[model samples]
Target chain A: MAPVKNGRYLFNEIPSGYPIPGQTTVYDESETIDLDTVPLNGGALVKLLVVSIDPYLRGRMRRAEAKSYNEPFKIGEPLMNWGVGLVLRSDSSSVKAGDHVYGYFKFQQYEIVDATRVLVLENKEGLPWSAYVGVAGMPGQTAYHAWKEFAEAKKGDTVFVTTGAGVVGATVVQLAKADGLKVIASAGSDDKVEFMKSIGVDVPFNYKTTKTAEVLEKEGPINVYWDNVGGESFEAAIEYAAKGARFIECGMISGYNTSEVYQVKNLMKIVTKQLHIHGFIVTDLMPKYNPEFYSSFVGRIGRGEIAYKEHLLVGLERAGEGILDVQSGRNFGKCVIVVGEDKA
Target chain B: MAPVKNGRYLFNEIPSGYPIPGQTTVYDESETIDLDTVPLNGGALVKLLVVSIDPYLRGRMRRAEAKSYNEPFKIGEPLMNWGVGLVLRSDSSSVKAGDHVYGYFKFQQYEIVDATRVLVLENKEGLPWSAYVGVAGMPGQTAYHAWKEFAEAKKGDTVFVTTGAGVVGATVVQLAKADGLKVIASAGSDDKVEFMKSIGVDVPFNYKTTKTAEVLEKEGPINVYWDNVGGESFEAAIEYAAKGARFIECGMISGYNTSEVYQVKNLMKIVTKQLHIHGFIVTDLMPKYNPEFYSSFVGRIGRGEIAYKEHLLVGLERAGEGILDVQSGRNFGKCVIVVGEDKA
Candidate 1:
């Protein structure tokens, strides 16, 4: 077999604030991978299909010594994230050639990865390949488990979700609305706001134009708050939180790439309002709720009963730009980089 | 029968910061209550025994228009609080003359209060009357329920408690210690630190002399934080919290009086560390947990198995000074004003 041209985004430098796509993530397209003869060593050789570029990846662009829930992207190596891949060759019984798999993988077009890192997944849903790494995958499971465990919103309860057009936030907004709760959600752009409204968000606004506190003061005293982009909006949520409100802290995308983190001045309201603020890493809940989530959401998402919008960057070469777009709030929907063609 | 001399503390002025002992609270000792002839319309004429002065009262010193969990102390009226009283005369079936009752009452030597405002309690455990308003009362219940519901801690878990010498904090320290958790507690003074140590606190520090962050960084990465004084210490707690740490926000006494509320810069840790920060009003839990708390703690407290320290101010004339001491963080233990003697 011919040596296939491989493109990869290498972690070249640790970033201070927002990662500079070209310098921080050096896209090297000159490399080649001989998939037919590469060493498997009880592992699998995977051709990357669709890769999810999420805001959480920004947290990994730090010094190796700094501690966080996710490991820092190592310098001189490929940046890593959850992505869908087609297993081309395998020495492990867990995966075979031509099987679709999803898990943590390198930000490269082709790679030899340990079997443990990838889980063989059957895309019976006929949804887009990106859905395997996104809405029906990790982010979907995150939204599902977090809302189930913490949101605790009852019928007629008012919920406010930030980043409502993004994958995780939009899922929670829909779930909240499905439970007969009034959903107030925010997005960065007018288009995203419209998308939020299209998805049954009772009150949708572009946070870039309107102040979050003003909107919340008028329409909320939110019973439940799904926090995705935490900063000024987080402060507002705390300010307008109803007594016994629950704040599900899923992500803080706003603070991830910035040096000047917004100071929350109204935490005293947490005490006065008797609020419950819960933060959780989805992976922690995966062992307990992943199966439940797959059973609950996969079929719904596939049949078009639950909608998942994808902002696709059609090549691995665009992975760096896609991540930057996500961190800067420029990308709408679930941002996914298509590394290779998916076989129908 | 002769009219009895009555001394009371009136809410004379709304305070901007800390309430002034004399100006904000006007001590009126000229009024007299005719004990024999005063009408009790379906209520009780009670002689106040011991009254609790808490930092929460500072929140009520605001303008009447300002909303809070508690009502404002109306101008020219007596300041009200939880107190133990003797029912000198009763026109209600709930209480008879000579029975000891506990409830919300004015900071006066004598008053006629509605029956619904008080509950008759027989001190079968023979604890001090001050205990009825202090350790064995609302403060104790606050500590008990807040800890049981939110602490969610296990043995060997490192716990940090602020205001460790106060009634609620000390009780929590003891409870955490009883559960075999490592307790690191802070107090305002060296004397109070000694009291914390005496109450089985593993590490006791005088926050006045030592920086909270420095101590926490050295001794912590605390698993549970019982936040009574929320300001600099609360920020320190967030910074040093272990993964999935639980913060029981029982009170934010540090912010109750000041206009300059502490701006927390590290709430992003709430997401990264997967923290659970819970705020609750103990009163909300009372109907369900109050009886359980008394049955569980009263016998232990009475037998001296569970220690309670009281900071006593021995007269109705000292009520203003007592409340000032409490709000300023100057008073130690349970700040209780002994209004009248308890008949043994």
Candidate 2:
């Protein structure tokens, strides 16, 4: 084949608040990668199949270095995140040509990466290739780590998950149910609430319409709070937390895009209720938990014991649109860009 | 003994913010308790010698039933807290008629309590009777439990204690120093800064004059924080916390008397820095750690290795003023009302 045309998204300017389309420049043919030009350093040339768009990417887009757990995305560089691809050419014995793999890579159509840096997807188990970017991937591992390590979830425990219809929250809801815990979930819209209900959420409420504190007062005394959306939801969780409750601080999507952070007034409840509020990044826990996650979590997904949803936007040029959809809560579930066909 | 005419302070009305003079009622010679009157239960009749005034009393003054770890003081009843006393008569064998003891009791000139409810002070070590209510008592126990159980303070670790010159903060500063930890303390006034310095604080700053965040950035990336005064101070601690720091939440005196709690905006630092912020009531840990506290901690105080200060008001009628002094940060150390002389 004559060199395949490569398309990529570039970080143009750091956003002040919510990122706009102009902040990221999309080039349909940013470069051309020749198959004959494979690296001699035991690397693989891969065609990107799917790119996972996550909320944490917003924190990396700051003008100044935000004191964060992860490094900020450099301006004038290709935005990088978790993605899965098919190896078109390989010089390494670890991964051969046509092997499916996933790892951190740029949001581009095609690229060459060191074979040791990417994990070969050994057992897709006849599942959709996109599953490697969603339930059977990072988000799935995050839910697993949080529940097992931080939540201390037990049978008959009551858990409240914010953004319940989203990828991580939905997975957590199903996991809690499977473990015999009652799950209460909150979402922004009616459809999302219904989606959570369909997925075995014991109680689902539209947070925009019904007050979380009011609903919690009626239905709660929450034992575990899986906080995906912060600000008001955090305050509500504090108000309804059982004594010695576990507050798993997964993400703060509510404050990610806003210039003004939500002023949490009732943090004293942490003391009064003797609650434990712990925040963690999934990548930080992966090295220790990845083996169990890949073995146990992957088998569950393969057997359909766990389910997932995805909103796939085709082509690398639409990556920015996918991020915007996720940011606006317009996307139904795990948002991903389908860069090329999975020929597995 | 002319019946030893008794005076008492009663909880009148709950205050909206800070307790005013009228919120607590001072009754001089309210009733004459005849020494002849003895309880049906085998109890001791004690002449209250000193009443310990504490910041936590503000929480008990809230009109609404705050979901607190402790019970609220009832209106129309004598305000109760840790107090030191001289036994006038004994119906039980725990103590004799002339023994000096201390425990939780009413803020009154004299009262009858079950003998099992009080602990006799065995070794005065030439320390003042007031020491039982200050250094050798509840506040001391609080600091001990916090450091031993939650702080996990290590040698060379930098600890920042808010209200550094006050009872609990001063005790914490001394304890940390004894443990070979470097100490940074903040107080509201210049004299308090000097007081903190006298107690061996490595760095002392008047929070009113110098910004806690700026001073901390200059002097430290605090490894452990003992939070006595929350709000701006807690926010400042979050801004300068070292990675894997421990924040010991002792009290929020800054917000105790205010209608509006300070909005802590930098709490996300807890996640980024992987900090552990745990709030504990000293009493909760007493059952588990009190033996160590009394045995090891009391010996330290007796040997002059641990020091303390008392801001004493001369009469039971001055209890309201004592509380107000603590509220306004006017009291230099452990505020207490000296109700009567210790005649042991």
Candidate 3:
């Protein structure tokens, strides 16, 4: 390969207020090139190919405590992030270079990771490497584990999921369909509605156009609400929740700019209907943060049991805007920054 | 002995706004009393001694599918409610005349419950009978279960509890104390503050005087928020919640009739902190709606291992106003309408 030069996009500056245009910074390969010598002390180098952009990253950019899942990115240093990668070099030899893997890493062209944090891929199978950064990664794990642990989803129950075509939400819709439930999802556009339908969401509504309450009144008293967007979506979920409903709070994309502070009319529902609304981080609920739960999911994608779609931005330079697009609900499916081809 | 009456406080007219004089139509005692027969079914017939006057009862008077814990009280009925009582007769022998019990009952002077719902007062040593309506009753169970199961408190953690001297809140403050944590509480009056302190709340702030945010900032970053009031109290809890905190949604007395809505800000605390805020009904979380838990608690109280207290208002004439006073945060302890006094 072209004598591996440098890294790419990372949390450059802690963002304040809304992300202004051109907030993300990237390094030219020539300027930040690593020395020809690898770390002999004990390190492995990986060439990151695909990095996932999720709505939660915006919260990480902010200077706040009480974060949901992963800790916030440090203010100045290159923002550490999550991605699918290919191992380019290794020192302690559990395996040689050129094996595929994925895990949390900095947004970079090439970087070193402690051997333990680097999960080596055994089989790419027929599934593209991108699936690791989307469906077969945290997205699928979060969806499956959340439903299994927090929510009680029986067959024939009406399911409501906001940001339905998102990484985790999309997986949840499919998982619910597999279990024989009626799925009603909310997305941002008409095209997304069609996209959701292809993947098993029976009724997908464009929340921007149709009011969630009016639709729920005609069709609902929904039994389960997998909330991806928090503000208006949470209000809708609380309004339509059936008696003994289960509200699984996944993320809050809609109210990222505003940690909503106001009164809720449905306060009585929590007691009257005896609703069980829970806010959880998937990793925390797991008995052990095991890859086994994800293995079957990966196998599904590898065997073509599920579809893994992605919004791939061409260069690491484009990731900043890609993150903005994903955060603002402009991009559909799993947003990924394709930093480089796995050409070792 | 006074003959039992079945007259009701009816919602003959829906209030256009906040409650005023004449909104409740109390049918005269002469209208519904059944004085002809002393005979009753076996294992039933309770002489109600204490009735709960929680603020959420106000919602039952309305005519909407507003979120609620108990179904709205039917308009023409005396209004089904929660109470502690003494059995007048019991042919089934599970309970005999003069035994104390607690469960769902009516607002009338006497009630005949089947064997299915009555919880017998088996252990009454250090604990008083009033605890059956207060700390050792439904309110106590609600506080204990919510704070334990949902909030997951541990030693040295900081907790914030609203409506601190109310029946449930007072118990929650002590239960949290028993677990070895610092508690910051909000109450309406200075006397209530002293009551909270007596019950183990470390810092009691009179909510009527001090701003909630100011109190939280001075003594916060709370690990658990036991909210006994939903309106602005719920909003402030979210703001003060610590990273990875658990917010326990207990009740909302603050917004009894103002706009029928509760608002909350600082919602981003959910994701950013990975918060596990749960809106729950204690009965559901406890298996069999509280058999072992309640009985074990009673055992504790009898052994002087637990100390529970309450506020009792004498006579049925003031029951309506007692309920209103409880809703207004005027009661210093558990709000119970006393229907009789033991002649002992």
lDDT of each: 0.88, 0.83, 0.72
Pairwise lDDT winner, candidates 2 and 3: 2
- RMSD, every candidate, angstroms: 1.5, 2.3, 3.8
lDDT score at residue A81, model 2, on the 0-100 scale: 84
Across all models, the iRMS values in order are 1.2, 1.7, 3.1
lDDT of 3 by residue, A105-223 (tens): 88778777776776777764666667776777777778888888666779899899888888788888888898888999988899888888888988888988999888787778899
Estimate, for each residue in B1-344, the C-alpha lDDT of model 2 and write its tens digit: 34657787888888877787655554446677777664526888898999899988988886555667778888888889998899988888998799888889898877888888788887647667777788788888888887888888889999999888887889999989988998999998998888888889999989888889998988889999998878888898988988778888888788777769788887666666767777777777888887887777888888988767789999888888888889989898799889988873
Model 1 C-alpha RMSD vs. true structure (Å) is 1.5
State the local distance difference test value for candidate 2. 0.83
Residue pair clashes in candidate 2: none
Model 2 lDDT tens row, A7-111: 878887777766777555444465777776746467888888998998878878875555677788877778888889999888888899889999898988778
For every model in order, the fraction of real contacts preserved is 0.89, 0.38, 0.48
For model 2 chain B, the run of ten residues with the poorest summed lDDT: B21-30
Ranking by DockQ: 1, 2, 3
Q: Can you write out model 3's per-residue Cα lDDT over B97-205, one digit (the tens) per residue?
A: 7777777777777666786677777654555566776677777788777776776778999999888877777777878888898999988899888877777788898
Model 1 misplacement above 4 A = none
Best by DockQ: 1
